[model samples]
Target chain A: MLYTPHLTTRKIMPEMQEFPMLSLSSRITPEHLFYIRNHFPYPIIDMRTWGLQINGLVNRPLYLRYHDLLQMHQVSIPVTLECAGEKRALFVPKTRGEQWELGASSHAVWTGVRLMDILKAACILPNAMEVTFEGMDKGVRTDMQGIFTYMRSLPIKEALNPDLLIALYMNGKPLPFRHGYPARLIVPGWYGMASVKWLQRITIIDQPFKGPFQAVDYVYVNTAKPVETIRLNSTIAQPSDQQVLAKGEHLLLGTAISGDSPVLFVEVSFDNGMTWQPASWLDPHESYSWRRWCLKWTATNSGTYDISVRATDAAGNVQPEIADWNEKGYGYNAIQKIRVYVD
Target chain B: MLYTPHLTTRKIMPEMQEFPMLSLSSRITPEHLFYIRNHFPYPIIDMRTWGLQINGLVNRPLYLRYHDLLQMHQVSIPVTLECAGEKRALFVPKTRGEQWELGASSHAVWTGVRLMDILKAACILPNAMEVTFEGMDKGVRTDMQGIFTYMRSLPIKEALNPDLLIALYMNGKPLPFRHGYPARLIVPGWYGMASVKWLQRITIIDQPFKGPFQAVDYVYVNTAKPVETIRLNSTIAQPSDQQVLAKGEHLLLGTAISGDSPVLFVEVSFDNGMTWQPASWLDPHESYSWRRWCLKWTATNSGTYDISVRATDAAGNVQPEIADWNEKGYGYNAIQKIRVYVD
Candidate 1:
């Protein structure tokens, strides 16, 4: 059993737990404290019998055993995986899903085989528009009563991006039984939903895949644009939500990661978003890894304030002061607002 | 005799007018077009007859002619003088006083000897608690009717600070007739109230000065804290109030001045104050000089917006999101909001 007493657990069926402020604790989250978000209980698997099936819109419908897949190639890549409903607690009228605060995200170094190499070996058809991944774990969702496996799809070009990986190990060790054991798909720049765990099947489709998680669950139907990549964001660690401190000099620590664009600069505002100061970087910049940052703040007055943090990416995308709200409360990256009392 | 066609001249007796946004024209405001905020008609005087009398609690009561005062060692320093009621027009319910907008302040080079030297020469008496200055000009009041001069005072220590000066020159030339021709008192880091024009007499007293400008007029009785030194502030210049422009990349220029502190950073928010971008500097930094800054904004969407600009100073004072309201609309330095249409 993973010892993660610090993380806030919102539910047990899906086994959702949040990561603590890593900038305050450790730069690389240990496997035990790493956040776990599962749609179903850990599936029992035997490496000898476990195999991945690649069909539909492929020149060759190929089936590769787990051991054979691992023998092809191996590389290590650090990636941050965030739940679609990362900050769902911010929604008004109370969103119906897991009401997460600041957890539901984690970073890990995965030793894996290139997903691009497998797709090339399977000879993906030219007509393929999308690629769908199916997990081995199955369960009946509370929202819809039906035996189903968690599934998601990505654009064909994104699915074949060299950044994609099929990992057989976590943090240098063979993958843990609960973390897919034999192998799992690792989609670099998409939400954790696209990184299907307990992976077993892959399908190339000529049109958008209508999986439950794709069509009915994660999409923000109310908004004009559907939710996809995680919005650029950063959060304060030392002054947790509703924390208190004496008026004096203090250091604020946090971490930030943007999906498609590299995190350019992270700003911390002591007085909401009225004025902001750039937080100094604690870690060298990286695309998929969360950058650790901290800023020295001299709290001059004693009053309540919404200490906020927002990030801007190289792509000119500013973390909107207030992220647009959705019914399911998906990508709620409105400047990570933490109210605190300075006395 | 000075040509300033764009200034809104409110009265002929007092000669009250405002400077146009010079960021759209020039950086250092031309002496001729500098905003004129007179409480009374400009006082005419012969240089030989103009003598500054030092009396009351001073160790030696002395009178120095204008020529004798100019003979003292002098230094040039940049100081921004902002009227206490700079942007009073923004107040609702129509606060009394000039319904001025964002043009009542300007920066200038003041050449003079430090007021500290004069105090040292006369040997300020220990009993003195405040030092008062009375301008030569006089007028009848609208709020409190009675013949009165534009007089104000400050604490003895503040009045004798090395930064305080009796300026004899404006922009390297002898002061213009309308701007206190022979000499004027410059109280750095305080509102224009402390910088009395057409200086005539200085009285060091054992109490806080209680002239109409000091007691009944300038003070905001409605608020717990009396309105004082110009609040930390900034204002947009290029995109004039309620101006319209095509949807494209536009540069916004502005200026910010603080009383006791140096302007540190200025921020501009197009969508009210929800989001802000750091504006770039146009000139070298100078204490007391209104900094010239502009930011390149690509207006992608077409709509009306209240473009806002707020500034912070090195002393850690942030321009309040909203200025405190008062009956007289004094020290209106809230985030300068300008509504504009983009088509």
Candidate 2:
């Protein structure tokens, strides 16, 4: 089915577009408005001939048609997928890559068969250490020679997690071409990069995967470790930076999310953090989805005010005042500061 | 002479306004456009009754009229005065303060009597260790009870610096009321906080002065030291962040400044600092004023580009990729990053 894209384009060649956060009022984002992060143009696919191949270090090397996965038991869940370099432009040194602001993130309910069920049927070998997923998209990287396909790997234990799914549908509809048509791997609670789209092959390997996307691009250059869980973060949707408003009551809006835990609270500061007041949660707490929040603010004085917001997760992760800098500019989750004027 | 204020008001109570940097073309800012950093409302003064009292540790107590200062030899020099809180909003942890961006700075040629000459006339005693300058503006601070006047002190050595001036004229005209009317202290090479405005008293002390502006404010909270010299910095004036443009040659404009030393070079990075190219200097180097620089860039691809700028001083101080985080958010001279799009 064809649909009009609702994302704001940041890049044209590879077609990278981000969701408009100001338009978000619901926990589940519309499928069309879901942010699109692509490394290459959508790979042409003939759904009639498509098949999923599960091989390497397994008892049964199975090649099953797309219809076979639909026949298996399915699970549905709402998950937030945020780009690893979501706020790359805000980094101090400005790392090289897509200069995404705070929009390269979105949430949606996905429905598909659990990967654990499929992996059990394949009968993984005892020596297997990782599961590598490969997509059909190919591209030339300036850092490396020759054309290469997008690929990534996850630990054996993580691959078998109950929440991991080979998603076939998004928001109760067949996945669109831009988001991977026949099937895609959905690794919840992790960055979008870990969930390989346009997925065609899965290999259970005996050792770690060394593909550039897995070992180089997605890894924090300063620490040489792959970025995993999402950091505790909050974004202000109202009274944007340098916005002028009338001196009276105003509603402040934002969203907070974490990867492994639910948000405990979100705080808003009007006096440059001298004091913080709790913001009311607008949405029910969900383990894998962002919670919308709002605060009623009254500005009696006419002047410029510095407004800041911070969030804390149930796992004791408080949004930092300053995130650690990385060369790739991944995972910047510092408290948000927006300066506005009351006139 | 009445002139229209060309500044952008940041605060209206204490009358704080900032220069519109995009309107800057010359090294010296117009008197009406120079940024104003005030702690309190402008104090009313009668020229017939106004006198500068120089006493305390001096062997001779002297009160000089405004004309008395004009009788002394006058020295003129261009100086750049930057607020300590400039760029406070850019701090990662989100500092508490005015939330000033890059506009809280300006350059001007000041004509006045040398502060050293005035001190010589006052005859400093051997016990003098520090010299304090006090302003007439008074206000009540939330951090401290009761009323307090804006005051700051300089070391005896720095007080004797030949470059320091009792400025009476700014940009070839009598100092405007918004800027310090009759006479003001100009602490060259130091942050603007040290330059007491509406000068009414000067005291030489045997030890350090512990006024709030000296002991508490105008300090790096993390270091507990008074912020002094300005940091090497640069600001982009053209093709602002998130600005969209046609895919063609465009001129990138900006200014670089330093306190004690001249800016040696300014570099622009197109590939997230992987490589940097030198920008052509447009203004001649001045000891205490910002120099304008520009680069002609051609965007061949239709995509977002992360353009960054960094300035290096002759003193070997290079702008940092990440400035050290401070509670008061002083001295943030990190390299600037502006994302622009070509379509």
Candidate 3:
């Protein structure tokens, strides 16, 4: 038999220090772990040349260098960072791409100044319906041709939440090179993709930013329908990636969140998508981030078993058994099914 | 002025190596990063004396040594382990407790022998309604006088899930001392409290295990009520414990799950509980585990602000703005509000 540690006693060495935590525990420490995601290579910004241009739908166009931004009202807030597709690697059914085993999310304490403060300095415009942010990352998708720059936009109303900011430090320290240093945007409760790194410009426009990063990519579509529709989805993040288990009774634990509404409950199935049982909630702190839940199950037979999990939000949204597959594989929140073995 | 990183570039580290995706990117390797949650010191068992006794309401009492369990049908399953209060520390109300900043959860490839196989060997009695598990950890709570052994119980139907097991190893290795070693219960889709570490005995009973661990200790009650009522709640895991942020447009992201039903949606409020907005779902995967979601907000003012998040499940279960407070802090899914600042 392949010997493996039980769930309560597994020991794994971490690759990096400063594992992020909401509080602290013996099992998880600050130095041993935490996941990191970067959209652009760390930009080597010359503080002298780093200037933020706020124009477009605004009444005033202002150019604020790094020094100018520093001179503005400085603020710090505790916020969380989540990848748009943190669990996408696990949702790829039969397809091999960036196979992330559910470890793409994290939290941190950000310290910086608010974007609204800078925008206010430039006077608000009347027709501003959306706010667009441009980053310094320069890359192109294999299927696309242009040297695509990473950019994201949000409704102007969302741009006014008091938690948003332009960060320069993390965890009470200078931003690391791997993490966007010098400057970055912090969208307190949105996906990490919306929080553009190496931020350079903020444009207030009457319409949403129709950039490659926004309209072309990161959008989910129905696999059975046309590619124009965008739907919502969620993912699980607790069970390790590619985990092998000797099943009897096991707790299914992870997190879930939604776009249209607040997550209500999480469901689990052990009988190859046959029966699903509601998992218990550990904490449903917010609708914007993942909620933690757990299900208890016992392994009765010995065979390769398929286990699947899905979620529903308060808005009556249930995770589809199969997400509409889009060409870019944007929103793949289909029922996440895993194959395990009983002795 | 404080400078925080952009929410887009900020990354949330997964709780464990098994979980590798975030709102934006995936962790590069499993070894360097991963989350871990340990309940007690790992125990070493002598196979000769370390026998599992199945008694109580069973038709036949059976005492099987560790070796005997190995001889029985062995099982393995991939599961996730999470602390009930992994993100409690981030609550802005400043509850009196060990503030966990997140990372009190983890996923692992667990290998173990099936519990049902042994239960069948003992011949379960017809009147059995619950199964109780006993572990080696013993402690005394301020409310209780005598030294109490750690134990928990599950309904007979839940104990019969085909994925549950008696985990012996984790991540393809012997159980670590910090985690439950020798043997432990792997109750899939439940909180870590249910998966008793250092397991020593299994008892079948017609009554629920009303021990301190179940009734008084690991339970939650509405503080406003008589503290006897049980209330449900949820948590977000992505932004991660005390994440400092800069003021501007940002995304608040995390995962949530529930025990009674599937998570429906997550909501966020930046103005100290003045208004609420729904977060976007990144993946609608398993409801038993975690669901990923995010909220987009732009900081308009610069000051210490309270950000709150709440969740609702498919069954119309909304995380209460205030949960009943129990003596033992369980079910703390009240609207988790965080205090952040913009410059």
Candidate 4:
């Protein structure tokens, strides 16, 4: 293990031990600490030889040197980079695997050259609808498993969002090596995995990149059905589970986002899965991003009760009770159930 | 200085260094990543010798040891812990002091006991409108300066919120020595200063505590001649200042919170003090907590434009163009203005 600082150990306060919490913001200082999940040793990139390649469904398969790319137009965007499995801490039965208890997500002010600028330079064909990002880091699994290249894809529209950029700086400084340095993707408001670090290549295609990383790995399918379908899920960040409440009113708070659609309404339940109440939501105009929501919960009854919350998106999709089981945990948006006692 | 990792230097590719950017998340990790603004160093706390004293305007002045306090009703709350000067990075030249650049906030699942439960244990009396918190940290600025003790007070209503907790654990573990071992106030969604670490005493008063920290420091006053009154202001977390933009449509995002009032609307302007548009808002219920907002803009014209965003509270309070100045940088919510250039 690397020389983990005392701060990293101190970061996990006793009050937060039960759940895995990942800092989501990118303004990393003493207060905005970083919890890193490294699959392999940190890679060192020599800027002298580093270059970016754009190929596949483009008019020109160009190999631009790093200096040449910098000569192009530069753009900065303030976007939220979240981990797709942010609320993995709320998972009950303590699912086995890379034990990630919250703290896997963060937001950042990414400054970089926009990918759209590069695509426009390459003259993207109208038939291109999928964009794939390949990173320099190699995926490491079990000993028997061969090392595979790490990559993920996004819809061309999302890839073309002016907010999306090839990030180079973090919090007004150069990107940390542990984070994707030199250049990485800044897909605001999406899961961390979607923002590929150690970026090497960008490919445009007509269809989704149904590779092992996207198809068998991160994708989730229901356990009960013959047809594999993705399940919607949401989580509550405030008013944590098993919390003891005073005999008064309080605010139940957290954020919700959907993979397939935009969040329309979020409902909170003070009594397990019984009576439900509506939570006030912040509108984002776009349906793909996450929405923050809160509900006024008055603790009239002074006793132990389970507080549960679920969310529905504009596509008439509500968070399910259980997420479909997959080889790799992805799309685990189930009904988040928390226990709280009122005194 | 501590072992500030040279992670960014070696890892960043040379091609990506031209743009300066920062991540949106305040803290990236729990320990070394989170910023600690201590009025004083770590206090040596002995649970056996440590005791909590609750007095003033109450039916009974109760003195309880750590063990005794633990035996009392326990409460846990998942709240976002923010520092008053979180966005110091965005502070313009006229408002530079403590110089904290956006690394002064965090959120955690805090678990422990409630102060209200103890107050209920010691029968409450009428006329209790304010509750004051005192810590063990003491300091004297330079030499010969008067000794100042860190103390703050909250409204009786805010103190009694079921979400408020006397946290003993963070992220679900014992408190670290640096982070007020034994006990501390977890005022979810408020600035970190409000959640005084190294808690020592609690006192109920008939009126708000008018101390230096409360009345003089951390308080914002207008900068106008014969300055008008002090009020709430707005802030953006993503775009600090001088960020680059691509020549296309992009979303401008950040979070804002009003003191003691719910944010009614957030407006964004791209042409420096000219026309403004409403930014999308999230969860408008908790006036005391922060709200995230975003606005979409098309950068068809390629030039540097001053992007300014202001927020209005439900009480009809709007962020000013020129925030009132003070000795310390409190309430520096001058209509936050940033410069972004389109190709």
Better of 3 and 4 by TM-score: 4
Q: Distance (Å) between predicted and true CA of B314, model 4?
A: 67
Give per-residue lDDT, candidate 3, residue A80. 49
DockQ of candidate 3 compared with the true complex: 0.02
Order of candidates by lDDT, top first? 2, 1, 4, 3
Query: Which runs of model 2 end up more than 4 angstroms from their true locations?
Result: A1-343, B1-6
Worst 10 residues of 1 chain B by lDDT: B1-10
Instruction: Write model 3 residue lDDT over A136-249, tens digit each, in one string.
Output: 776645344567667888888878876688887777777654456667888865666787777888889986577866775566544342222123454444332223344457
TM for candidate 1 is 0.49
For all candidates in order, the CA lDDT equals 0.76, 0.83, 0.59, 0.60
lDDT tens digits by residue: candidate 4, A41-124:
445577888888899899998787767766777776645445444445345433323434334444345678888888888888
What would the per-residue lDDT of candidate 1 be over residues B1-343, giving only the tens digit for each residue? 1111244343334566666663335566778667778887677677757799888887888798887888999988888888888888676544555656678887788998788888888888889899888889997764454689888888887886788889999889988777776778987667787788889998889987878788887788786454567678888876665444567788888887877687889988878888988888887887667788898988777776778888888988888877778866788777887766665
Candidate 2 chain A: minimum summed lDDT over ten consecutive residues — where? Answer: A1-10
Interface RMSD of each: 29.3, 16.1, 19.7, 22.1
Question: Per-residue lDDT tens digits of candidate 2, residues A211-257?
Answer: 98988788888888889888788888665566556667998998898
Tens-place lDDT digits, model 2, residues B102-132:
6899989999999999899989999999999
Q: lDDT tens digits, residues B166-230, model 4?
A: 87877677766556667888776566678888788999999868766677556654442211112
Model 1 clash pairs are A18-A104
Task: Give the distance in Å from residue B215's predicted Cα in candidate 3 to where it truly belongs.
Answer: 47
- What are the per-model DockQ values? 0.01, 0.01, 0.02, 0.01
